[model samples]
Target chain A: MTTERVDDATTLTDDERRTLAAIADRLIPAAHGMPSAADVVTDERLRFALNARPDLAEPLRQALRPELGPDLQARLDTLGADEPATLYALQLVIVGAYYTDAGVRDGIGYPGQVAITVRSWEYPQYLEDGLIDAVLARGPVWRDPATGTRARTDNAPNTYAERFGGTPPEGDTHGHDRA
Target chain B: MASEPADVLIIGAGASGAVVALRLAEAGFKVTCLEQGEWLNRADYPGNKLDWELKARKDWATSPNIRGLASDYPIVEDDTPVSPLMYNAVGGSTIIFAGAWPRALPSDFRVRSLDGIADDWPIDYFELLPYFYRTDKQFGISGLPGDPAYPPDTEDAPMPPLPIGAAGLKVARGMTKLGWHWWPEFNSINSTNYDGRRPCVQRSTCQSGCNEGAKASTDLTHWPKAIGLGATLITGARVSRIEHNDKALATGATWIDRDGAEHFQPAKVVVLAANAIGTPRLLLLSGLGNSSGLVGKRLMMHPFANVAGLFEEPLMSWAGQFGDLIESLEFYETDEKRGFVRGARWGLAPTGGPINTALPSRAGEQAWGPDHHLHVRSHLGHGANWGLFAEDLPDEANHITLSDTVTDASGIPAPEVHYRMSDNSRRMLDFHIERAKESMDAAGAYKIEVDRLMRYSGWHLLGTARMGDDPKTSVVDRWNRSHDVKNLYVVDGSCFVTSSGVNPTSTIVAIALRAADHMVETRFEQQVPA
Candidate 1:
């Protein structure tokens, strides 16, 4: 089902549109207790809103098109009927993909039913789980052993696993128990 | 010369000043208070939605939010730095603050000693506990008696807690699920009836001034009691300079009344309760505190940022005590791993009015458009917004000086606030963001859009004229008496040693109460040499 309305609004290219949808969903992914981020139509609505603010819009569009490729644009252009409905429906699917994508969800720390304040301090065990494999993803407690200081680590667990080439010791690999 | 000389002269009949006047007058000392702002009454408050922009329906000059010595108060500026001063009216900024009256945690009084950040206050919480109790009874605070969260649960609050709304429920559920601590916010507002004031109607416009007289701004709280004691209040008299002897002992002060006519009043003692920014600027500009040279240093602003969550249900933040609930103090303790010296308290702040909710950064264009309207109708109720008020460390760089360009109608240089977050503050913000995001997600928010961190300019601006052990490093001694002026005293947030991450009103009032008693004892009973 799609929204059945038409409005004369600034439009985003399919590539840019998809990227926006992906990021929005990554920030708030779908889960068991809540509606999927895609269901909210945050991306499509944001695009139409940003159309008036070109300074921000142009930068956003430029960032998205590289990942979207030409084929999706051609398909979107041919299938479009009512502008809002077509754009919105397209957004729903892309956002759905963004929410379901495990890697992206993990990168943004999209834990289901998050209690932000408690989680503000990371569970020592979660770091062991390699869930905190990235810097930006690390909460303040994730201290860098070498510097005797705090810094953000990388979110790419596979890259980390590759570099280390071995499973981390039991307590170091999964921070689930600590969480 | 014909003007009568009083035993004590108090400038600005506001919160701290009025309290001092009452205490002094009750002690049989003749007291006169001169206020530069209009003597607005309880009926003057205009409770409206437009208050978000206009700052509680106040005219910029007459408005307590905008009035200050360095800003609205008259001065001839020629590139010299000045600061924004507060109101010179009866009951000063207390006339315009959101009646969030949380007492300073005991750690607040001893932060420098406990955390090794700022200097220790002249007195500790234990010394001021009796005053805190007295003032709480006087103001009729609304809170529960015991929670084991922090301390001396003296008695049940004069009134019951305000009813928590949808926003409160969402925050409480989220916090409970996460095993975080929670409690009702202690407000200097009458939830039921106390001191002849009515209960709150939950108009949720307390910041714009409450017409119901439920929220205890001094106009409704302290003034009536103070006035009943035969104290005379002179409004719209802007204090300009402190007149003293060659010894720098304060004997009198000069001020310009509302008509721009100058009046000099003599007194045996003078009290400066003109708040943090104004108090120091007055001392510095009047050339009365040069011996200490610490009038405008160690300036601290409890810079706060809002971290909100968009929940799955309407939190109708506009409906009640701006969210009656607050979360645990589990994180209120500092840890070395967080790379911060102090801790922050998280609370549920409901900030979703038409203007604030529709921030260009947050709600975006969908705010007014058809989609935006739908989003608001659907998700605005779902607005489960919470915020983190972290304590910013005392950074010498974050000082309030005179602006180079802008000046108010009075020609005083606008207060040029130089504020930049320390690495510690940045780390605190990062931690707060992570927590805010987690709460939003935990509260079943379908989508969460968090605003990036920005400098919070207003929240108990303190420490410009900090109290300390040494004269050179401090403006006022521990008793809030100017080190240079033996008889002049500053009894406001200006005397704060550090800006704790909570509302400073209670602490300020407590300290002022203590100082008043001390002054009485010292002047009449015995003399302690500085």
Candidate 2:
């Protein structure tokens, strides 16, 4: 979303905020028992997202500018098709702001990227669960070429000479299956 | 340098360079490592912070081009879809790696013999066994022994395996239903307190650098011991070229510091431990190690794909380390019947945090409109992705060359990659995606989304400077020594003969250990240009 380097973290004016709110609502309206992007793009939440990713400030400002036109869906459609980068900044803040909301995070039952105390690794229960009894029955899956015994197995490649009775398949050094 | 010449000077103090430096220093040889990027503080890692996901999307992104840090150099990826993902810092790419540390199978060595394709490596898999064991401990690896997917020598990891959390168990069940070969992930991240580093706390922000030091990047595991052993590690020293003589012996290297000041550090021997891309760029710049005209040919980049599945359960898919969950090698070997010459491997990983899950870039479309919240709600803690890492057969076409237009901060020409995924790799990816979707189906996923090809997943860089017995066909010999330059060596992934289906870091470190130790074993016969 933060595409290029910028010297300063630009902020949106009051008119820009209104335009972004209208567009954010179109992008992520209240549906399926979820808060809209406009509902989630609160001052507190936007501030949090911007503080975490200050590089997005200029892109966010550019995405919401009035020069992009008044028809919200038309503006978004044009940006989505042609100016995808600007649209990326728009969605990152709108959607990113929506996800960063505490209520939204709680609704999804995601406590965030919290650290967990990892207990000592016990012997894998899969052994007792009989998950690999069938796998072990299939024997080894790899081919050991260092030892000649393993190389002679059914795992060895059936070469073109072995298959079609010719020299090593030639013509394409890049491994293209030339017809 | 102002001081007398060292016994060995290593360029690029990443995993390989760090290993070589420590071993040479312990053997009482004067060793010095020049790293382009500085030593990073643990606090700089985003894993421990509240805004970790925010950082992951921007400054801490895996692609150096996207991260755009001062230490990063431009890799002109215009010719290919696969973007080269690497860090230029002292820890190298490991700083941003997810730590899936599996050694290449024995068959990866003899591709020509077993698979009738790429040239067989001069050295065999068994030669790297001892070094693998040593490096497993050095990096504080963790896994269960006897995976049955590999040789019995596989696993036997130094520590217990990280927990196969709720998500892992779900995927493991899917593999079980399919009667496929699956194993708990083998990783360089610690499961227990190991070598004075903390155990993995399941922070899951592993790709953004592990702040807890649970992951064994070389900065934590090797550089400290090397420096303590009196090995010099000069950070922000970007090497320009290797200085060689008519005798075909490397004298030293000319490097530019942070202030653009150039200096030549002399050494009896020089080791290029820079990653696959950086090493070839330097070799092209130096105009040495190219007698075979293979200094930057035969590139293997292991094209990647992803299949993310959504389940009804909140599996805490964002809670644990990204990839150290479970892996299935059900189809990792060659299968002629599958319409592909080579095969691919699958590792079950957590779909990351809210920002990553909701990003429009992943789906290649806006996650806006009606499905905006529904998208995040479904994938946040309720989905897992099975990442397919397909073996890209070495092709002269998918090679690296010097870019005439693009340059780094110091005006040095950048490396340009001319990579296009082979027909074999595409078929392999297509085949794996179907199987992965089946696995997801067996796991009772309600919906499955496939990123058919990952454009930015060029993490494993290999085979640019291939190693073989014949000088005419390769850049280095069996022991990773440059055939053209007797006193020079390239021990990074550039020495890879074949790109294995699984991760390459484990093999990269083990090979470096063996080559550096071989130096210790044969120091008496070592030659110097000085």
Candidate 3:
């Protein structure tokens, strides 16, 4: 995404901010026990998303121009039908900022993605209760290409050294075999 | 005035190219690779950062037409239903792949022989079987063995299977309840510490890239090892076309750098390991290896769709390896009774974070006003999607051609795609979509949503330059040598004889390793430029 044509002039004027705020509220209103768009669509959050996608800055600015009328819902409908990219730009900025809001994420009881240290692998609880016993019992679904029948996978020689007539390298016999 | 030629020259550094470079270099051959894109730093992927979701919509988008980077080439895909998605980096499209590591089933090789439709592969599943074993360890694939989906693996995964988290558990329960086939999917992502890479923490941003380097993009899996064995890789060197001698043997390639400077790379043998579209485009541009007029024919991208189940329980669906939690091949084989010649494969994948729930980066449009929050709250962390990838059969009518009007930044003509979804693919997807919905319903979901025929789901680019015994129909032979040009090989997905109902990376690299091994076994007999 590092393109030469990216425009970095992102200092928004007061009028541009008002234009974006107006569109943001209509795109994501206050509902579903969540905070309003005003709480999430801050100038700072929008800028962060904008910086990550610098190529969108000029289009986003153009979308926030004085061309949009005050009838916000109707304006959105018009943009959705006529200028879809502009509407999409505004929507992307709003949704991006809304998720970044710490309060909103906390209120929703969702912590952002974080790395967890994996301990020794163990089968989860559900799998322990015969969940996949049926699958294991249904052996060897793959067909033999030569005969066009389900191959005898259980009784078949499982390695090159076995059926295909070659010796496997020393001590090699599992998914755990590292080259 | 030119430097001494290397033993082998590879025109890409993606999955197949990286593997060939590694294998040939290990065999003590002097190898050089030209990559259009530079190596990506694993840490720079948006998985760990704030505003990470937004990156998926813009910068990290899969379709190169959307990314608009200097490293990317524009594709004229207006005529096609599916876009040809690829990455031009050191690891290539593996940079953005989901790392689902399912090997092509045995039946997948003989589509023509078994089904009597497409042409049979000159080489069958057994030829590449040993290489798959070696390549699986090379990439550190994680999975449980003894699934009825395929022939049994001789050994267990080098590491343990990835934890099938809450979302996977629900989907697995549903599939098992129906007495259908489902198994913990084989993934190139690390489940435990293996191959010197950290285990996956399941951040679920796999499609964007693996920040923890848990997922095996070839840059991590093969390039470093290949370079260690003395394969010289030149980044920012976009190969314009394959160069050949008057004797019709490939010499090397003429490449253009980032600054628009041109240079000729000399080699005794040249390998075109670019993806299906890129390889065919390069060949078409150079006017080589198309004497059969099949260089850019028979394009096949898996006709892809998604079915999401919304449950009451907070599945925390956004918090795991998003690609291969569980896969079902219950309907993988063909059954003409279902009104289709072939079938589809299904994999359970976690839906993304809030922004993705509100407006999926690839899905078109979003709900606005009051309904926007409703859409967000209902799906944000409560859903798991079953990706339905139907096997798209090759049709000669569907193909890629060089665009007369379009070109890349370096002014190389962009490849134009002409793919039409077949009646078989359409019926296959329709039937699978309903079955997938039924599977979701079995999982105790309150509601199900279907995203049918998503345009951006065109990751599996294949079959444009297929391999066969017939020189009149195929681009490459069973050994992957171009029928028209000796010393020139195509070892990527381009040489796939048939499009299998699984991810192509494992098969691609495995076949490349087999080809590289063949080259080493018969090095003294290989033809080169005069």
Leading candidate by TM-score: 3
After superposing candidate 1 on the true structure, give the runs of residues whose Cα lies further than 4 Å from its correct spot: A1-179, B48-88, B358-368, B402-414, B454-457, B525-530
lDDT of 1 by residue, A92-159 (tens): 33333333344433533332221111111122232243322332122233122233233233432232
Could you report the DockQ of all the candidates, in the order they appear? 0.02, 0.25, 0.40
The CAPRI category of model 1 is incorrect
lDDT of 3 by residue, B368-400 (tens): 788877777778789889999999898889888
Give residue A141's error in model 2 in angstroms. Answer: 1.6
lDDT of each: 0.58, 0.82, 0.82
Could you arrange the candidates by DockQ from highest to lowest?
Answer: 3, 2, 1
Worst 10 residues of 2 chain B by lDDT: B146-155
lDDT of 2 by residue, B223-300 (tens): 999989999988888888899888878989988887898889999999999989999999999999999999888888
